[model samples]
Target: MDVSQVLRMNGGDGDYSYSNNSLLQREVITMTKPIIEDSLTNLYCDMNFPKTLIMADLGCSSGPNTLLVASELVKSIDKIRLELGNSNEPIEIQIYLNDLPHNDFNTIFHSVPKFQKKLTKQMTSYSSSPRCYVSGVPGSFYTRLFLNRSIHFIYSSYSLMWLSKVPEMINTNKGNIYMSRTSPPSVIKAYHEQFQRDFMTFLKCRSEEMVRGGRMVLTLLGRQSDDPCSKECCYVWDLLALSLNDMVSKGLIEEEKVDSFNIPQYTPSSKEVSNEVEKEGSFMIDCLEVSQVNWDASTDHNPIFSKEDAQGYNMGKCMRAVAEPLVLSHFGESIIEGVFERYTNNIKMSMSKEKTKLINVTVSMTRNG
Candidate 1:
């Protein structure tokens, strides 16, 4: 499948839509706000506080998280303006929200009016003509989307793990989608090679598009261990594969179909991420750290939904919002609900054995002059 043309989160404001189910992503964004703010602060001051600050949010899927990030960035800039005694400097902000063409840009565009209104209210006191402009850029981030040396700050969260395409020669990864303990060494090699190529392409494009001293903050799902098949990274997919297998056993899905499906995602190790930055020689890593966020982090934020299976159901819905489109395209919509029901049950069962968390690698970087 052509991921650039095919991949998208479930759209609209429905219950299963990515917009509603993206609280986990929002939580992660909130968790990393301090890092992003600090990095942007340094970039702003180092650039001598450009009168017009230009920035882009790559893979900015449609959701609260999309505008939440934009608002946070605006706040960070205003703080710098205040610190530098330029409160009346009349700052102009240009923001580009980017994702694949298949993403629900309509929802984001519809939400922009409210976002701008809210942002305008916040800047009324110390700033004037500090209006913010937002536009959606449609295309693959693996390729260039902006003019050379135009963007000042870049931010992406929980997005880089998606490969441009499923790895070639991945037929060896039968019966399991994504990397698993059962996947052969060749399968892991192919996935890693694909990630490396895509990531380098990303860096090369961004390097050409960013001014000297510009900053980037990226948060991607990664593994704590060097091993590609570590439980922390692969177990989510393992349980998902198990769900598909359960369908096959019930004769709801063909075994061959289950064998043919492999998710085009790979959570890299910290070493892998750092190695690519060093190899690409475009951005200098200012901070590279790993943190674990529980699969049930959303549960704590929403108190109304306390129940025996809330966490499992919540996580299952979250994954569905992100993964349903791919699953629908591959396996048909007939088995989608059944697959996730099994997935939720499997998650609850596993959580009983031990609590699991997503190993997140958040790296702050600056363009090398």
Candidate 2:
């Protein structure tokens, strides 16, 4: 399957739109807000207050989250400048929001005016208004998109775990959709090699596009252990695989299709990420932090705990938003609901036995000569 063509969060403001179901991503953004603020502040300091700041948010899926990033960044810079008390020389900021071509750029564009309006209001109290330019750049980040040495800072959240494509030789992972405890060494090696290639390409492209001392903050779902098949990393998919297999048993879907289907994603450990950066030789890893969040944390906002399906369904909703397009493209839309329904049931059962959490890895890197 051409993942680039099919991979996208469900679009539009309907029930499954990424906008509504991206609470998990929002939680992630909130968790990493301090890291983002610190990085932006440090980048500004390292660049010596350049007249123009070029920033890009890679894999900026459509929704409030995208604009929130831009807003927070503007606030960070404004805070720094306000402290400096420079009323005469405010910086010009250009933000390029990037994602796949199939992403809902229209939704993001429609929201940009509101974003700009709010930004203007926020800047009114500051000494000088920083001219902010926001535009959508639709493309894959695995390849070069920006001009050479043009960007000063780049940020990505809840992305980069997705591979450019599924491993070319995943025949060994017959019954699984992702790496699992049962997956063989060959399957693990294939995934590791793909991540290395893709991440190195990412570094090389960014190195060319960013000026010296440019910095990047990336947040992705990753494993906490060296083992690629660690439960925290692959358990979700293992449950998903079980759901597919159950469907196959009931004749809801084909066994061969389930066996052949592999998600185009990989969760790397911090060591794995750091090793890649060192090997690429163009970027220096400044900080790497890992945190975990429970699967049911979404329900914290809702006071009345009246539903048994809350936790599982909440996670399922988020997962559906992210992977529904791919699932629909491959299996047809008829089974989408049923698949997730069964998947959530499995999650509900598992949650009773043990708490399931996903690891969030944040890495801060600086460009080197």
- Highest lDDT model number: 1
Where does model 2 exceed 4 Å of error?
124-127, 300-308
| RMSD to truth, every model | 1.5, 1.7
Relative to the unseen true structure, what is the C-alpha lDDT of residue 347 in candidate 1, on a scale of 0 to 100? Answer: 85
What lDDT score is found at residue 361 in candidate 2? Answer: 89
- Candidate 2 per-residue lDDT over residues 74-142, each given as its tens digit: 878888777766557878899999999999999999998889888989885644778789988989999
Question: How many angstroms is residue 50 displaced in model 1 relative to the true structure, after the best TM-score fit?
Answer: 1.0
Off by over 4 Å in 1: 124-126, 300-306
Best by TM-score: 1
Model 2 vs. true fold: TM: 0.96
Supply the global lDDT for candidate 1: 0.88
Give, for candidate 1, the lowest lDDT window spanning 10 residues.
299-308
Root mean square deviation (Cα) for candidate 1: 1.5
